[model samples]
Target: MAQHEDMQEIKKRRDAVLSALVDGVPYHRFLGIGFDRRGDELTGVLNFEQKLIGNPFLPAIHGGVTAAFLEVTSIITLSWNYLWQDMEAGAIDLGALEAGTLPRLPKTIDFTVDYLRSGRPRDAYARAEVIRSGRRYASVRVEAWQDHRDKLFAQATGHFLMPPPVTEAKAGKPG
Candidate 1:
Protein backbone atom coordinates (compact mmCIF):
# COMPACT_ATOMS: atom_id res chain seq x y z
CA MET A 1 0.00 0.00 0.00
CA ALA A 2 1.09 3.55 -0.63
CA GLN A 3 0.54 4.42 3.00
CA HIS A 4 2.85 1.65 4.16
CA GLU A 5 5.59 2.79 1.80
CA ASP A 6 5.19 6.32 3.04
CA MET A 7 5.59 5.14 6.63
CA GLN A 8 8.83 3.36 5.78
CA GLU A 9 10.15 6.45 4.06
CA ILE A 10 9.33 8.57 7.07
CA LYS A 11 11.18 6.21 9.37
CA LYS A 12 14.24 6.42 7.18
CA ARG A 13 14.12 10.18 7.23
CA ARG A 14 13.74 10.26 10.98
CA ASP A 15 16.76 8.01 11.47
CA ALA A 16 18.86 10.22 9.23
CA VAL A 17 17.98 13.32 11.21
CA LEU A 18 18.65 11.59 14.50
CA SER A 19 22.05 10.45 13.33
CA ALA A 20 23.04 13.95 12.30
CA LEU A 21 21.95 15.50 15.59
CA VAL A 22 23.46 12.92 17.92
CA ASP A 23 26.75 12.32 16.16
CA GLY A 24 28.83 14.93 17.99
CA VAL A 25 26.77 15.84 21.04
CA PRO A 26 29.02 15.41 24.08
CA TYR A 27 26.23 16.08 26.58
CA HIS A 28 23.91 13.66 24.88
CA ARG A 29 26.66 11.08 25.14
CA PHE A 30 26.88 11.75 28.87
CA LEU A 31 23.10 11.45 29.32
CA GLY A 32 22.39 8.75 26.73
CA ILE A 33 19.76 10.91 25.05
CA GLY A 34 19.51 8.93 21.81
CA PHE A 35 16.07 7.54 21.04
CA ASP A 36 14.10 4.92 19.14
CA ARG A 37 11.03 5.95 17.19
CA ARG A 38 7.81 3.98 17.09
CA GLY A 39 5.36 5.43 14.60
CA ASP A 40 4.84 9.04 15.70
CA GLU A 41 6.33 8.68 19.15
CA LEU A 42 9.92 8.94 20.40
CA THR A 43 11.34 7.26 23.50
CA GLY A 44 14.67 8.35 25.03
CA VAL A 45 16.72 7.05 27.95
CA LEU A 46 19.04 8.89 30.37
CA ASN A 47 21.42 7.47 32.93
CA PHE A 48 22.43 9.06 36.24
CA GLU A 49 25.95 7.86 36.80
CA GLN A 50 28.52 9.39 39.14
CA LYS A 51 29.16 12.10 36.58
CA LEU A 52 25.54 13.32 36.65
CA ILE A 53 25.13 13.21 40.39
CA GLY A 54 25.73 16.65 41.87
CA ASN A 55 25.11 16.40 45.61
CA PRO A 56 25.82 13.31 47.68
CA PHE A 57 23.29 14.26 50.32
CA LEU A 58 20.35 14.51 47.89
CA PRO A 59 21.81 12.16 45.24
CA ALA A 60 19.72 14.20 42.77
CA ILE A 61 20.24 14.82 39.11
CA HIS A 62 20.78 18.50 38.48
CA GLY A 63 17.58 20.33 37.54
CA GLY A 64 19.25 22.22 34.74
CA VAL A 65 20.54 19.03 33.13
CA THR A 66 17.14 17.40 33.29
CA ALA A 67 15.55 20.48 31.74
CA ALA A 68 18.13 20.51 28.98
CA PHE A 69 17.45 16.90 28.15
CA LEU A 70 13.72 17.45 28.01
CA GLU A 71 14.09 20.51 25.81
CA VAL A 72 16.50 18.85 23.38
CA THR A 73 14.47 15.66 23.06
CA SER A 74 11.23 17.54 22.44
CA ILE A 75 12.75 19.78 19.80
CA ILE A 76 14.44 16.90 17.96
CA THR A 77 11.32 14.74 17.91
CA LEU A 78 9.13 17.58 16.65
CA SER A 79 11.64 18.52 13.98
CA TRP A 80 11.72 14.93 12.74
CA ASN A 81 7.94 14.84 12.49
CA TYR A 82 7.94 18.07 10.52
CA LEU A 83 10.67 16.88 8.19
CA TRP A 84 8.96 13.55 7.63
CA GLN A 85 5.69 15.18 6.70
CA ASP A 86 7.40 17.64 4.36
CA MET A 87 9.26 14.85 2.57
CA GLU A 88 6.17 12.64 2.26
CA ALA A 89 4.20 15.50 0.80
CA GLY A 90 6.91 16.17 -1.80
CA ALA A 91 7.62 19.57 -0.33
CA ILE A 92 11.29 18.88 0.19
CA ASP A 93 14.07 16.31 -0.14
CA LEU A 94 15.24 16.62 3.44
CA GLY A 95 18.10 14.19 3.03
CA ALA A 96 19.37 15.92 -0.10
CA LEU A 97 19.63 19.32 1.56
CA GLU A 98 22.75 20.28 3.42
CA ALA A 99 22.53 19.81 7.15
CA GLY A 100 22.47 23.56 7.66
CA THR A 101 19.50 23.91 5.34
CA LEU A 102 17.20 22.01 7.66
CA PRO A 103 14.45 24.39 8.73
CA ARG A 104 12.70 24.65 12.08
CA LEU A 105 15.38 25.04 14.68
CA PRO A 106 12.71 25.49 17.28
CA LYS A 107 13.34 28.16 19.89
CA THR A 108 11.46 27.65 23.05
CA ILE A 109 8.96 30.49 23.27
CA ASP A 110 7.81 29.32 26.67
CA PHE A 111 8.21 26.31 28.88
CA THR A 112 6.81 25.10 32.19
CA VAL A 113 8.39 22.18 33.98
CA ASP A 114 6.93 20.54 37.06
CA TYR A 115 9.07 18.40 39.29
CA LEU A 116 6.89 15.51 40.32
CA ARG A 117 9.61 13.51 42.02
CA SER A 118 13.34 13.78 42.54
CA GLY A 119 15.43 11.73 40.12
CA ARG A 120 17.39 8.90 41.69
CA PRO A 121 20.93 7.99 40.78
CA ARG A 122 19.95 5.59 38.01
CA ASP A 123 18.69 5.35 34.48
CA ALA A 124 15.83 7.61 33.48
CA TYR A 125 13.32 7.38 30.66
CA ALA A 126 11.45 10.07 28.76
CA ARG A 127 8.56 10.09 26.29
CA ALA A 128 7.48 13.12 24.30
CA GLU A 129 4.02 13.75 22.96
CA VAL A 130 3.40 16.25 20.19
CA ILE A 131 0.26 17.98 21.28
CA ARG A 132 -0.11 20.25 18.25
CA SER A 133 1.88 20.97 15.13
CA GLY A 134 1.27 23.99 12.95
CA ARG A 135 2.87 25.72 10.03
CA ARG A 136 4.95 27.98 12.28
CA TYR A 137 4.90 26.44 15.76
CA ALA A 138 4.39 23.34 17.85
CA SER A 139 3.47 22.32 21.38
CA VAL A 140 4.97 19.33 23.13
CA ARG A 141 4.66 17.60 26.47
CA VAL A 142 7.44 15.42 27.90
CA GLU A 143 7.49 13.10 30.90
CA ALA A 144 10.64 11.73 32.52
CA TRP A 145 10.97 8.87 34.98
CA GLN A 146 13.72 7.08 36.82
CA ASP A 147 14.03 3.33 36.33
CA HIS A 148 11.59 1.33 38.47
CA ARG A 149 10.17 4.54 39.96
CA ASP A 150 6.43 4.98 40.41
CA LYS A 151 6.47 8.77 40.36
CA LEU A 152 7.67 10.86 37.45
CA PHE A 153 10.85 12.88 37.90
CA ALA A 154 9.59 15.78 35.81
CA GLN A 155 6.92 16.88 33.38
CA ALA A 156 7.31 19.73 30.93
CA THR A 157 5.31 21.53 28.26
CA GLY A 158 7.04 23.66 25.68
CA HIS A 159 5.94 26.13 23.03
CA PHE A 160 8.40 26.20 20.16
CA LEU A 161 8.78 28.69 17.33
CA MET A 162 9.61 27.21 13.96
CA PRO A 163 12.26 29.01 11.95
CA PRO A 164 11.49 30.20 8.47
CA PRO A 165 13.21 28.78 5.39
CA VAL A 166 16.82 29.78 4.97
CA THR A 167 17.48 32.34 2.26
CA GLU A 168 19.25 31.10 -0.86
CA ALA A 169 22.41 33.08 -0.06
CA LYS A 170 22.64 31.62 3.41
CA ALA A 171 22.06 28.20 1.89
CA GLY A 172 25.36 28.80 0.07
CA LYS A 173 26.19 28.75 -3.65
CA PRO A 174 24.38 26.00 -5.50
CA GLY A 175 26.57 23.05 -6.27
Candidate 2:
Protein backbone atom coordinates (compact mmCIF):
# COMPACT_ATOMS: atom_id res chain seq x y z
CA MET A 1 0.00 0.00 0.00
CA ALA A 2 1.02 3.61 -0.44
CA GLN A 3 1.09 4.11 3.33
CA HIS A 4 3.56 1.27 3.83
CA GLU A 5 5.76 2.57 1.06
CA ASP A 6 5.70 6.00 2.60
CA MET A 7 6.86 4.60 5.92
CA GLN A 8 9.74 2.81 4.23
CA GLU A 9 10.75 5.98 2.46
CA ILE A 10 10.71 7.90 5.72
CA LYS A 11 12.86 5.30 7.43
CA LYS A 12 15.38 5.37 4.59
CA ARG A 13 15.60 9.12 4.76
CA ARG A 14 16.11 9.01 8.50
CA ASP A 15 18.96 6.55 8.14
CA ALA A 16 20.58 8.64 5.47
CA VAL A 17 20.47 11.75 7.61
CA LEU A 18 21.96 9.98 10.61
CA SER A 19 24.61 8.29 8.46
CA ALA A 20 25.76 11.55 6.94
CA LEU A 21 25.94 13.06 10.40
CA VAL A 22 27.88 10.40 12.36
CA ASP A 23 30.11 9.33 9.47
CA GLY A 24 30.52 12.40 7.31
CA VAL A 25 31.57 14.91 9.96
CA PRO A 26 35.03 14.66 11.47
CA TYR A 27 34.60 16.81 14.54
CA HIS A 28 31.46 14.96 15.52
CA ARG A 29 33.31 11.68 15.67
CA PHE A 30 36.14 13.20 17.66
CA LEU A 31 33.69 14.46 20.22
CA GLY A 32 31.92 11.10 20.51
CA ILE A 33 28.64 12.82 19.80
CA GLY A 34 25.68 10.54 19.32
CA PHE A 35 21.95 11.07 19.26
CA ASP A 36 18.99 9.74 21.18
CA ARG A 37 15.77 10.41 19.35
CA ARG A 38 12.42 10.40 21.08
CA GLY A 39 9.84 11.08 18.41
CA ASP A 40 10.76 14.44 16.84
CA GLU A 41 13.16 15.40 19.59
CA LEU A 42 16.84 14.59 19.51
CA THR A 43 19.29 14.73 22.41
CA GLY A 44 22.90 15.01 21.30
CA VAL A 45 25.25 13.21 23.68
CA LEU A 46 28.93 13.75 24.16
CA ASN A 47 30.13 10.62 25.94
CA PHE A 48 32.40 11.41 28.80
CA GLU A 49 36.02 10.59 28.27
CA GLN A 50 39.16 11.35 30.27
CA LYS A 51 40.86 13.25 27.48
CA LEU A 52 38.09 15.83 27.43
CA ILE A 53 38.90 17.07 30.89
CA GLY A 54 40.09 20.68 31.07
CA ASN A 55 40.40 21.82 34.64
CA PRO A 56 42.52 19.46 36.67
CA PHE A 57 41.29 20.92 39.94
CA LEU A 58 37.58 20.62 39.19
CA PRO A 59 38.11 18.03 36.46
CA ALA A 60 35.63 19.46 34.04
CA ILE A 61 35.13 19.13 30.33
CA HIS A 62 37.08 21.69 28.36
CA GLY A 63 35.15 24.88 27.56
CA GLY A 64 36.22 24.67 23.94
CA VAL A 65 35.18 21.04 23.64
CA THR A 66 31.81 21.79 25.13
CA ALA A 67 31.41 24.79 22.82
CA ALA A 68 32.25 22.72 19.74
CA PHE A 69 29.85 20.03 20.89
CA LEU A 70 27.01 22.51 21.24
CA GLU A 71 27.74 24.05 17.85
CA VAL A 72 27.86 20.70 16.09
CA THR A 73 24.67 19.61 17.81
CA SER A 74 22.85 22.64 16.42
CA ILE A 75 24.25 22.07 12.96
CA ILE A 76 23.38 18.39 12.92
CA THR A 77 19.88 18.99 14.23
CA LEU A 78 19.22 21.66 11.62
CA SER A 79 20.68 19.59 8.81
CA TRP A 80 18.55 16.61 9.76
CA ASN A 81 15.45 18.64 10.41
CA TYR A 82 15.71 20.27 6.99
CA LEU A 83 17.10 17.36 5.01
CA TRP A 84 14.82 17.86 2.03
CA GLN A 85 16.26 21.33 1.62
CA ASP A 86 19.71 20.55 2.98
CA MET A 87 20.50 17.50 0.89
CA GLU A 88 20.24 16.74 -2.81
CA ALA A 89 16.66 15.66 -3.46
CA GLY A 90 16.47 14.53 0.17
CA ALA A 91 19.11 11.92 -0.63
CA ILE A 92 22.48 12.16 1.03
CA ASP A 93 25.20 11.26 -1.43
CA LEU A 94 27.54 9.14 0.65
CA GLY A 95 29.26 7.99 -2.56
CA ALA A 96 30.25 11.47 -3.63
CA LEU A 97 31.48 12.10 -0.10
CA GLU A 98 33.63 8.98 -0.18
CA ALA A 99 35.41 10.51 -3.13
CA GLY A 100 36.26 13.54 -1.00
CA THR A 101 33.71 15.65 -2.88
CA LEU A 102 30.71 16.91 -0.98
CA PRO A 103 28.39 19.81 -0.47
CA ARG A 104 29.46 22.78 1.61
CA LEU A 105 29.12 23.12 5.36
CA PRO A 106 27.17 26.05 6.67
CA LYS A 107 29.53 28.72 7.91
CA THR A 108 29.06 30.24 11.34
CA ILE A 109 28.06 33.89 11.17
CA ASP A 110 27.66 34.27 14.90
CA PHE A 111 28.08 32.06 17.97
CA THR A 112 27.63 33.13 21.59
CA VAL A 113 28.05 30.76 24.50
CA ASP A 114 27.24 31.28 28.15
CA TYR A 115 29.03 29.15 30.68
CA LEU A 116 26.82 29.09 33.72
CA ARG A 117 28.81 26.62 35.76
CA SER A 118 31.72 24.22 35.59
CA GLY A 119 31.10 21.41 33.09
CA ARG A 120 31.69 18.53 35.42
CA PRO A 121 33.53 15.52 34.01
CA ARG A 122 30.62 13.43 32.88
CA ASP A 123 28.50 12.67 29.85
CA ALA A 124 27.27 15.86 28.24
CA TYR A 125 23.95 16.29 26.48
CA ALA A 126 22.65 19.06 24.25
CA ARG A 127 19.39 20.01 22.56
CA ALA A 128 18.91 22.67 19.91
CA GLU A 129 15.90 24.70 18.95
CA VAL A 130 15.69 26.40 15.58
CA ILE A 131 14.48 29.93 16.17
CA ARG A 132 14.35 30.97 12.53
CA SER A 133 15.40 29.28 9.33
CA GLY A 134 15.69 31.28 6.11
CA ARG A 135 17.22 30.86 2.68
CA ARG A 136 20.46 32.58 3.63
CA TYR A 137 20.73 31.97 7.36
CA ALA A 138 19.43 30.08 10.37
CA SER A 139 19.35 30.98 14.04
CA VAL A 140 19.63 28.18 16.58
CA ARG A 141 19.38 28.12 20.34
CA VAL A 142 21.31 25.35 22.08
CA GLU A 143 21.84 24.24 25.66
CA ALA A 144 24.23 21.67 27.11
CA TRP A 145 23.71 19.83 30.35
CA GLN A 146 25.10 17.05 32.39
CA ASP A 147 23.19 14.99 34.99
CA HIS A 148 19.82 16.58 34.19
CA ARG A 149 18.26 18.65 31.45
CA ASP A 150 17.17 21.37 33.83
CA LYS A 151 20.66 21.56 35.29
CA LEU A 152 22.43 23.34 32.46
CA PHE A 153 26.12 24.08 32.35
CA ALA A 154 26.26 26.09 29.15
CA GLN A 155 23.95 27.59 26.55
CA ALA A 156 24.56 29.07 23.12
CA THR A 157 22.90 30.85 20.24
CA GLY A 158 24.26 30.43 16.75
CA HIS A 159 23.64 31.94 13.34
CA PHE A 160 24.95 29.98 10.38
CA LEU A 161 25.12 30.87 6.70
CA MET A 162 23.07 28.39 4.73
CA PRO A 163 24.38 26.92 1.52
CA PRO A 164 22.91 27.68 -1.87
CA PRO A 165 19.68 25.91 -2.71
CA VAL A 166 19.38 23.06 -5.19
CA THR A 167 18.33 25.51 -7.92
CA GLU A 168 21.81 26.92 -7.79
CA ALA A 169 23.44 23.55 -8.46
CA LYS A 170 23.29 22.92 -12.17
CA ALA A 171 24.84 20.26 -14.33
CA GLY A 172 28.43 20.90 -15.37
CA LYS A 173 28.59 23.73 -12.89
CA PRO A 174 30.91 23.72 -9.89
CA GLY A 175 29.09 24.62 -6.70
Candidate 3:
Protein backbone atom coordinates (compact mmCIF):
# COMPACT_ATOMS: atom_id res chain seq x y z
CA MET A 1 0.00 0.00 0.00
CA ALA A 2 2.85 2.40 0.77
CA GLN A 3 4.52 1.63 -2.56
CA HIS A 4 1.24 2.23 -4.41
CA GLU A 5 0.83 5.60 -2.78
CA ASP A 6 4.41 6.49 -3.67
CA MET A 7 3.76 5.60 -7.30
CA GLN A 8 0.69 7.78 -7.34
CA GLU A 9 2.67 10.68 -5.95
CA ILE A 10 5.31 10.26 -8.63
CA LYS A 11 2.70 10.16 -11.35
CA LYS A 12 1.16 13.35 -10.06
CA ARG A 13 4.52 15.07 -10.12
CA ARG A 14 5.21 13.90 -13.65
CA ASP A 15 1.82 15.12 -14.85
CA ALA A 16 2.38 18.49 -13.24
CA VAL A 17 5.75 18.85 -14.90
CA LEU A 18 4.27 18.06 -18.30
CA SER A 19 1.40 20.46 -17.78
CA ALA A 20 3.84 23.23 -16.95
CA LEU A 21 5.79 22.52 -20.12
CA VAL A 22 2.85 22.31 -22.54
CA ASP A 23 0.33 24.78 -21.14
CA GLY A 24 2.53 27.38 -19.47
CA VAL A 25 3.81 28.65 -22.83
CA PRO A 26 1.19 29.76 -25.33
CA TYR A 27 3.40 29.33 -28.35
CA HIS A 28 4.08 25.75 -27.46
CA ARG A 29 0.37 25.06 -27.75
CA PHE A 30 -0.06 27.15 -30.89
CA LEU A 31 2.75 25.30 -32.59
CA GLY A 32 1.14 21.95 -31.71
CA ILE A 33 4.12 20.77 -29.69
CA GLY A 34 3.56 17.82 -27.39
CA PHE A 35 5.90 16.03 -25.03
CA ASP A 36 6.48 12.44 -24.03
CA ARG A 37 8.26 11.96 -20.73
CA ARG A 38 9.81 8.65 -19.79
CA GLY A 39 11.34 9.05 -16.38
CA ASP A 40 13.83 11.92 -16.86
CA GLU A 41 13.87 11.81 -20.64
CA LEU A 42 11.71 13.94 -22.91
CA THR A 43 10.82 14.00 -26.60
CA GLY A 44 9.21 17.00 -28.24
CA VAL A 45 6.56 16.31 -30.85
CA LEU A 46 5.48 18.69 -33.56
CA ASN A 47 2.16 17.62 -35.02
CA PHE A 48 2.19 18.34 -38.71
CA GLU A 49 -0.29 20.64 -40.36
CA GLN A 50 -0.63 22.26 -43.76
CA LYS A 51 -0.14 25.70 -42.25
CA LEU A 52 3.42 24.85 -41.18
CA ILE A 53 4.73 24.49 -44.70
CA GLY A 54 7.31 26.96 -45.99
CA ASN A 55 7.43 26.21 -49.71
CA PRO A 56 4.81 24.27 -51.53
CA PHE A 57 7.52 23.49 -54.07
CA LEU A 58 9.68 21.43 -51.78
CA PRO A 59 6.74 20.94 -49.43
CA ALA A 60 9.14 21.27 -46.56
CA ILE A 61 8.39 22.36 -43.05
CA HIS A 62 9.18 26.03 -42.48
CA GLY A 63 12.65 26.88 -41.27
CA GLY A 64 11.17 29.08 -38.57
CA VAL A 65 9.01 26.26 -37.30
CA THR A 66 11.95 23.91 -37.17
CA ALA A 67 14.02 26.48 -35.35
CA ALA A 68 11.24 27.11 -32.88
CA PHE A 69 10.91 23.40 -32.25
CA LEU A 70 14.59 23.06 -31.45
CA GLU A 71 14.61 26.10 -29.22
CA VAL A 72 11.50 25.03 -27.35
CA THR A 73 12.89 21.55 -26.82
CA SER A 74 16.10 22.90 -25.35
CA ILE A 75 14.37 25.36 -23.08
CA ILE A 76 11.87 22.86 -21.71
CA THR A 77 14.51 20.19 -21.16
CA LEU A 78 16.60 22.58 -19.12
CA SER A 79 13.59 23.70 -17.14
CA TRP A 80 12.73 20.07 -16.41
CA ASN A 81 16.22 19.51 -15.03
CA TYR A 82 15.80 22.46 -12.68
CA LEU A 83 12.36 21.34 -11.60
CA TRP A 84 13.60 17.82 -10.93
CA GLN A 85 15.99 19.16 -8.33
CA ASP A 86 13.10 20.66 -6.41
CA MET A 87 11.09 17.48 -6.86
CA GLU A 88 13.88 15.36 -5.42
CA ALA A 89 14.03 17.62 -2.39
CA GLY A 90 10.21 17.53 -2.04
CA ALA A 91 10.20 21.30 -2.29
CA ILE A 92 8.02 21.75 -5.34
CA ASP A 93 4.48 23.02 -4.94
CA LEU A 94 2.20 20.97 -7.15
CA GLY A 95 -0.65 23.36 -6.59
CA ALA A 96 1.37 26.24 -8.02
CA LEU A 97 2.20 24.17 -11.05
CA GLU A 98 -1.42 23.17 -11.60
CA ALA A 99 -2.45 26.80 -11.26
CA GLY A 100 -0.03 27.75 -14.04
CA THR A 101 2.14 29.82 -11.73
CA LEU A 102 5.24 27.93 -12.65
CA PRO A 103 8.71 29.31 -12.04
CA ARG A 104 10.04 31.30 -14.98
CA LEU A 105 11.60 29.29 -17.72
CA PRO A 106 15.23 29.93 -18.59
CA LYS A 107 15.91 32.71 -21.05
CA THR A 108 17.82 31.94 -24.19
CA ILE A 109 21.26 33.45 -24.37
CA ASP A 110 22.22 32.11 -27.78
CA PHE A 111 20.81 29.43 -30.02
CA THR A 112 22.64 28.14 -33.07
CA VAL A 113 20.97 25.78 -35.51
CA ASP A 114 22.37 23.63 -38.28
CA TYR A 115 19.86 22.64 -40.92
CA LEU A 116 21.17 19.31 -42.06
CA ARG A 117 18.27 18.90 -44.47
CA SER A 118 14.88 20.35 -45.19
CA GLY A 119 12.22 19.22 -42.76
CA ARG A 120 9.76 17.08 -44.65
CA PRO A 121 6.11 17.97 -44.46
CA ARG A 122 5.20 15.54 -41.74
CA ASP A 123 5.33 15.14 -38.02
CA ALA A 124 8.76 15.99 -36.55
CA TYR A 125 10.22 14.84 -33.28
CA ALA A 126 13.06 16.27 -31.21
CA ARG A 127 14.99 15.14 -28.17
CA ALA A 128 17.15 17.48 -26.16
CA GLU A 129 20.13 16.69 -24.02
CA VAL A 130 21.18 19.09 -21.30
CA ILE A 131 24.88 19.06 -21.94
CA ARG A 132 25.78 21.26 -19.00
CA SER A 133 23.77 22.81 -16.22
CA GLY A 134 25.03 25.13 -13.51
CA ARG A 135 23.61 27.48 -10.94
CA ARG A 136 23.32 30.36 -13.36
CA TYR A 137 23.51 28.83 -16.80
CA ALA A 138 22.76 25.77 -18.89
CA SER A 139 23.76 24.41 -22.28
CA VAL A 140 21.57 22.09 -24.35
CA ARG A 141 21.76 20.24 -27.63
CA VAL A 142 18.70 19.17 -29.65
CA GLU A 143 18.16 17.03 -32.69
CA ALA A 144 14.97 17.08 -34.78
CA TRP A 145 14.13 14.05 -36.82
CA GLN A 146 11.36 13.06 -39.14
CA ASP A 147 11.14 9.42 -40.20
CA HIS A 148 14.33 8.28 -38.61
CA ARG A 149 15.97 9.42 -35.41
CA ASP A 150 19.41 8.61 -36.76
CA LYS A 151 18.70 10.75 -39.82
CA LEU A 152 18.17 14.14 -38.34
CA PHE A 153 16.59 17.01 -40.21
CA ALA A 154 18.18 19.66 -38.04
CA GLN A 155 20.20 20.05 -34.86
CA ALA A 156 20.83 22.94 -32.49
CA THR A 157 22.93 24.00 -29.52
CA GLY A 158 21.61 26.57 -27.12
CA HIS A 159 22.84 28.44 -24.07
CA PHE A 160 20.39 29.76 -21.51
CA LEU A 161 20.37 31.94 -18.41
CA MET A 162 18.88 29.87 -15.62
CA PRO A 163 16.41 31.60 -13.37
CA PRO A 164 16.98 31.64 -9.64
CA PRO A 165 14.91 29.22 -7.61
CA VAL A 166 11.70 30.54 -6.14
CA THR A 167 11.41 30.33 -2.40
CA GLU A 168 8.32 30.00 -0.27
CA ALA A 169 8.50 33.64 0.77
CA LYS A 170 8.79 34.81 -2.81
CA ALA A 171 5.95 32.53 -3.75
CA GLY A 172 3.69 34.19 -1.21
CA LYS A 173 3.74 31.33 1.26
CA PRO A 174 4.29 31.73 4.98
CA GLY A 175 7.97 31.05 5.57
Instruction: State which candidate has the highest lDDT.
Output: 3
User: TM-score winner among the candidates?
Assistant: 3
Per-model C-alpha RMSD: 4.1, 2.8, 2.2
- Give the per-residue lDDT of model 2 (tens digit) for 1-175: 9999977876666665566666677777777888886645788999988888889888888999989989988987877666544443555665665555545656788899999999998899999998998988999999999998899999999999887664565544775
Superposition-based RMSD of candidate 3 using all C-alpha atoms, in angstroms: 2.2
Screening candidate 3 with a backbone cut-off below 3 angstroms (N, C-alpha, C), the clashing residue pairs are none
The superposed Cα distance between candidate 3 and the true structure at residue 35, in angstroms, equals 0.5
Worst window of 10 by summed lDDT in candidate 2 = 83-92
Evaluate all candidate structures by whole-model CA lDDT and list the values in order: 0.73, 0.80, 0.88
Rank by TM-score, highest first: 3, 2, 1
Worst 10 residues of 1 by lDDT: 95-104
Which digits, one per residue and each the tens of the lDDT, describe model 3 over residues 71-152?
Answer: 9989888888888877766787778777887777899999999999999989999999999999889989999999998999
Model 2 has an lDDT value of 0.80
